[model samples]
Target chain A: MKHLVLGGVRSGKSQFAERWIAEQRKQIVYIATSQVWDGSMAERIAKHQSYRPDHWHTIEEPITLADTLKKVASEQPESGVIVECCSLWLTNLLCAENEAQLTQEREQFLAVLENYPLPVILVSAEVGLGIMPINALARRYGDEIGVLNQRMAQICDQVTLVTAGLPMTLKATQGK
Target chain B: MKHLVLGGVRSGKSQFAERWIAEQRKQIVYIATSQVWDGSMAERIAKHQSYRPDHWHTIEEPITLADTLKKVASEQPESGVIVECCSLWLTNLLCAENEAQLTQEREQFLAVLENYPLPVILVSAEVGLGIMPINALARRYGDEIGVLNQRMAQICDQVTLVTAGLPMTLKATQGK
Candidate 1:
């Protein structure tokens, strides 16, 4: 099953996705995309780490998400790999690489979503629901993230949008 | 019918609300909460005005929304009032007023929602689904908006969440 979970900041998307995937009873591979660049972010990361079972294999990969997924599949075919979020991964790529490089990475990631082997749950931020950002960087990030979510939703089997700590399934697999 | 329409930017909340109210065949009092403080904002306001029906009465009230609503109800109780958005109204209050003034204004607005005489439709932005803002002002705005939405949702007769141009009814009057 390929599931895409989306929400705003503190929308309980990560916790919801985690619980849903855990219910499947598969060995979990938690693919974290965040890098602790600041003190607050480090605290956030630590808080997230505390909730998950200590045995869940954790992989910290800010970029090269597609490559990491491929490697995980080969090593643990039966395990469900969770991509903690696409927004932070895109942020990393946006800041570190040029447009072409980011495009290449995004394309590769989408291509892999087409026929992913393992049960994969991709978490993403739904950031387009507010006012037009006053800053250029935030606007650019919103545009990229919105486009990525649409493309990912088209390919993924299921998509859930969380709001106010509630999960609403926007797209679901038919007859499953 | 009092309806609260919530969505992210470009999620079509305004259009959806406009269309819904237009279908009711009542005169609309478009209570805009934005003041054109800059060139970009002027453009945005102009663009919005262009799409709306020419005959619809428009009122630009950045603050004193509750007072304006009261006046509108008395002057044109038969007409439907559309508060263009709560987010902008809150933004106006956040910037111009002290905490005490803002609280009084917010309380008055909620008090009016309890039994709004005329058919009213309120629009708001659902902005909590994203990364924690990096700045203090943005963070404060997000927190305020989130709490406001929750309180508004509890009071409104109907709450519709718009996503990608579709409206999902989150709460609706029973037997309606």
Candidate 2:
């Protein structure tokens, strides 16, 4: 079952995803896609690390998410995979300033996700539900994330939007 | 029916609200809360005006929404009202730099909405579902809007979040 969990910052999306993946499988492959660029980001990464169970295998990959997912699915067929978030992964790509890499990576990720044989849960930021940012990059980020979300929602068996620590299901398929 | 329609910029929120209100009542009162601050805003307002039906009564109110709502309810008891948005109204207050007016107006609007008569639909930007802004005022705006959305969701009969022109219900009462 492929599930997409989307929410705003500090909206309990990570917590929700943690509890959910724990329920799906005992051995979980926790994929962390964040890179510590600043002091605040380092602090946030540490905070997230503190809450996670020690037994779960954690892999920090800033890019090449598609390859990572494939390896996890093949290596541990019995375990469930949870991508902590796609937003930061996207940020990493956007900041790289490689348009070709961005396009290729996004397409590759989606193609890999189409028919994955595991209980995978993907988390992403719902950044489109806000006013347009003044910065050009921020605006571009919003547009890209919005399109990514819409595409992911199409493939995922269930799509949930979190707000104020509450989960609201946007789309759900039978026998999830 | 007191409904709140939440969405991002160009997320088809206004169109959704208009259609929803049209289904509820024939005599519609459109309350546009946008203030023309620049050329872009004026063009956007003009575009919105062109799309709306000429028969619908339009009121341009930048502040004192509670009083305007009261007057509308009293004068035309049969007509339904759709406030184009609360976010721009918030911007107006913030730009004015009058902290007292902001608090009083927000409190008053919520109070009036709690037991408002006739079918009314409010449109607001779901600005909290994004990254933390770099600017102090933008951050404050997000916080204020988040709090406002939570409060309004509590009092509203139905709350719908629009994304990519799709409507997803967050909260709904039995009758609404």
Candidate 3:
């Protein structure tokens, strides 16, 4: 089973995804894609860590997410892999890689996602709803994230959107 | 009937709101809260204008949304009013006012919304779903928009979130 969860900041998407994964009764492998670059982000990361159970395994990988996911899947094929978000991963790539590298990395990530054996639950931000970004970088970020989401939605078995602490399934079970 | 339409950029929120209002058979008054400050913004404004029907009344009021809505309501009591968005209005307020004035304006807007006589469809971006802004202004904008969306949802008879052009009702008319 594959699930893609999307929501805005503080909309309870992470909590909801955590709860859903917990219900799966499989070993949980949380792949956190956040790199704390500032004090506020460190706090946010700490807050997220506190919410997660101590028993669950966590992998903090800021880059090379697809490679990390592949390793995890190969080691624990039965376990459920939860990628906390795609936005941060994209951000890291945006800062670290050139355009060609980003395109290659994105493609690699998508391939890994398609071939992964475990039940994968991915969480990402729905970023395009706000006002047009004033600067070039923010605008580019928005466009990339939007496109990434659309691509993920196409491959995932279930796609759910969380808003104001409410979840609505956009796509369910492929056929049902 | 009051509806709160929430969506990310290009989620077709405005189109959904416009279609809903068109079905009402009442006079349609679009209160757009964007001021074209640059070429990109001007293009956006023009695109929005093109989507709107020629017969529908349009008001391009960047600030003073509550006052404009009130005046329109009194003059065209039978018309359905569509506020293009709340974020831009908030942007205008943030740019033009001190904290005290913003509070006063927000309060006044809420009061007016509460007593609004005609059917109203309010559109706003669900901006809180993404990353935490690094700067004070962006962070402040996120907090204000999230709070604003919550407040509006409470007053609205229907709250719908649009994702990839799909509209899902988060809250609907009670018992109806």
Candidate 4:
């Protein structure tokens, strides 16, 4: 039941993914990776927070993603798990200001994906379709995230893209 | 040669679509639908503006979408377009508050899309992949946008999804 949901900003991708989780008949752990470093983001994050059911356990991991997922979802067999998003985690990884640390963190994150248990669902942004970033760092970030996404898509059992609020499964799955 | 690029917020989706446009050897029109109603949006809009060549014709149409596209894309064979995004337009349509008007407007948009010449690439968010929305309007807006996206995907020559800064073209040809 591993799933990948990808879309652009305000494209209704998040609401679609959340609805999917609400319908699932398993205990759930909602993993959110947002760090409120600004005012608007704080507001937006708050809006998102108010939408979840109180009973659904949530773990906020600004970093340390692999370890967090392993710790939270390792024991839940029947319940599904969600990594709310990947783009922020990638941002956090890229902006660590330590190049070696960034590489090590990314590799560790990728390594954790290999055998993580639970029917994991990941929400991530599809950011490479727009423009060629004019800066060196933005381009590098894009490339690295692109690689990470491809690996996720290859490993995940399903890949879903929502546009204009519609959900269309790219890597089709038969899960109810 | 029509194309649509879909991705998540800050997902580098806009940049990806912009890069695709920058590579085009044809005359270009940049249709920006974003309204800089606040400071954050203004900053983002400014960042995007800095990326373009000085000669590319620009059209700022927050409404009247079909008429604008038809007007700008009518003349040349080698003309291509980039719609910076559809989310704002979706919001525009929602705020119109007239179901009949929204229907008429969207129909006009589809009509304009029907016979437009050249490669027009639309950039939109892949929203609706998250939890169920809290309000009726939000839920309805999500559904409406989803319908619009599927219709556009059906008509366009190519549909690509970007996630974590990577893109995979799901539908690459018209009527496929």
Per-residue lDDT of candidate 3, residues A1-176 (tens digit): 78899988767788889999888756899999999899978988998999998988999998788899899988987688899888889999998858888898899999988866788889998977666557778888998999999999998899998776568889998421
lDDT of each: 0.86, 0.89, 0.85, 0.76
What is the lDDT, from 0 to 100, of the residue B46 in candidate 3?
Answer: 91
lDDT of 3: 0.85
Judged by DockQ, which candidate is best? 2
Residue B162 CA error for candidate 3 (Å)? Answer: 7.8
Candidate 4 local lDDT, B2-116, one digit each (tens): 7888875455577778788767645788899887787757976898889888888888988788888877765555667888787678778788788787888889988888776
Deviation from native of the Cα of residue A37 in model 3, angstroms: 0.8
Sorted on lDDT, best first, the list reads 2, 1, 3, 4
lDDT of 4 at B41: 70
lDDT of 1 by residue, B18-119 (tens): 998887546989999997789999999898899999999999999898899999999987788899989999998999858998999999999987778887
- Most lDDT-accurate candidate: 2
Candidate 3 residue-wise lDDT at B40: 97
- Compute the lDDT for candidate 4: 0.76
RMSD of 4: 11.0
Candidate 4 lDDT tens digits, A36-134: 889999999989889887788888987788888777655666677888789888887777777887777767877877676676788887666544334
Whole-model lDDT, candidate 1? Answer: 0.86
RMSD of each: 6.6, 6.0, 6.7, 11.0
Interface RMSD of each candidate, angstroms, one decimal: 3.7, 3.3, 3.5, 8.1
